[model samples]
Target: MMNDCSLVVGGSKGIGLEIAKLFSERGDVTYILSRNKGKWLGNHIEADLSNERNLNHVLHYIRNNKIRFKYIVFAQKNRSLPDDLDYELMIQLKSVKILVEGIAPSMEGGAFVFIGSPSGRFIVREQPLGYHLSKAALEHLTKYYAVNLGKFGIRFNCILPGTVLKESNREFYQANEDVSNLLKRITPLRMFGEAMDIVNAVDFFSSEKSRYITGQVIFIDGGQSLEGQESLARRLTFGED
Candidate 1:
């Protein structure tokens, strides 16, 4: 009669926090793993993903508690040292590898959803080379784990998001009406995605509805990825056609 459990890495803020909230509301025993303690109503495991010792401590805690996860989401990112390749790799990729390998054995046929970025395939000038490289590798890593862990009934998938309106950058978008309008014009959906947009997708992947789905890369960008690069650049540089 154990309660269903879920874990959200980097669930202290932004999209991660939203995802964690969804699980908490659904009556799951949700755990938020992050460097700082989250204000949400869930079990908080303080761990810096970049630090191996911190990760080890988290693993040990979970093992000791015998927590079998029904859903595991990775929404962590390190932008403090954008140019530091090692730091970016450690936070964005290595931590995921360590946790997945360490916890997959305890999972009783659940899903692992990675929150990635469109930078995985396209170059985002604002982001560093390491960010793009780590994200690209994360997509592949999702497929790799899905293939290798299928026998164990674990599913792995990645969600690559484009421009989404979250708490972190909501003000920026609101203040820059011109930029927001331009984004709307270029995107097929003619709107920016919200945090709930991502939460819904994660919920789907975590539920039994997506039991047959795995190793898939889904984008929830309001069709922004479908826009032509040249057209977008032209719109940004000049007036829209």
Candidate 2:
């Protein structure tokens, strides 16, 4: 059953959920892992990525299921804006380290795709939250993992989105006016990307099409990054800024 199973961490909602659906749609028996079931549609694991004990349990689940896979898709984000760097580091490192450790030795010759955001590359002149800093660290981690795992037939890569528009992002879109308009102009596609956009790219990586691509950060933002940091403040009000 090699290449028959696909494991997706944080696949309950948003981009992660979409990636899980893509795997299922393509006939890969997908396992959706998450701490809580949440409101997303998918079969899910009730375990915490930040918890070390749960990581052990996660491994047990994989082994007991005898699930060999051709892909491991990751879509976890550190959603914190703490005043202290240490606390923030713990949150960011926990998800990346545990998942990297759990999936690497278990899944072989498989493509590993992570959903990343543009915050890691261009400092959004406006959104300087620790979450963005954490993402930057993750981009580096992606490269590091790709380098170390290349010999094992493992490919690690990420998709960075400019503005992943969804129910979760509706508030952000409403709050940031200029950022929204800029998205309309720059993206050559001239439209906001749906969850499917990220899913399609990840699917490519999982299949033979992207067997040679690794440690790369694909920007799914259309041409939004080209708009520069100024787009960060596109829709801010006097009080919000």
Candidate 3:
């Protein structure tokens, strides 16, 4: 069953923002996580992902306050560009796990969401190797947690989004005719997916709507992974059916 007081890690901007908005409207006490402070419709928690201590502190606050929660969505977004190889990918996953560990005790059989990228499940570019590796490991972690949390009636799942257009990337794509045209032609939907698409799915699975579901990886791509994902012919469908 769904309950009030949900925590959304990386919920301050982009895709996370959509999730926060939906949950808040549903009357859930939603907590949005971001390192920077700004005005949001829902409550905001300012903290960096690399900071383990801060993660623990927030978790401790929730526990101390006896804030029972129903959903914990980790849409913690990070993009490892070709030049940004120095970033430690594991840090993101570990940080999310820390928060979950703290909140798990207070959850009454809920859903745990890990926002992953389609690159981890399918073809990965040579440039973002660390990012791909991290997401792949995240899937394994999700499975492990799902198995353990099963006894507690909590579900663990991952969402792999393909070619999500963030603010910076959206501008780049819109400006580049060649890149924009090619991407649209390849994806069956012939368009890019909005952040709301992802958040809505998380909300459904995290609510009582997905109580019997667990250990699943949902892809939010608009048939980009279809068997015929090419410059020709209709592509076969894939993911999150």
Which prediction has the highest TM-score against the true structure? Answer: 1
Task: List pairs with backbone clashes in candidate 2.
Answer: 176-235, 177-235, 178-234, 178-235, 179-234
State the lDDT of candidate 1 residue by residue for 1-241, as single tens digits: 7767999998988899999999989888999998786566668988888798889988999999888898999999794788999999999999999999999998779999999999999988999999999999999999999999999999999999878998789999999999998888888888899899999999999988999999999999888887678888887678764
Residue-level error in angstroms, candidate 3, position 163: 2.5
Q: What TM-scores do the predictions have?
A: 0.94, 0.81, 0.84
Ranking by lDDT: 1, 3, 2
- Off-target runs (Cα >4 Å) in candidate 2 are 1-3, 39-42, 79-88, 125-129, 171-179, 186-189, 227-241
In candidate 1, where is summed lDDT lowest over 10 consecutive residues?
34-43
TM-score winner between candidates 2 and 3: 3
Query: Which ten-residue region of model 2 has the weakest summed lDDT?
Result: 232-241
**What's the alpha carbon RMSD for model 1?**
1.9
Candidate with the larger TM-score of 1 and 2: 1
Error of 3 at 234 (Å): 12
- Report how far residue 174 has shifted in candidate 2, in Å: 7.4
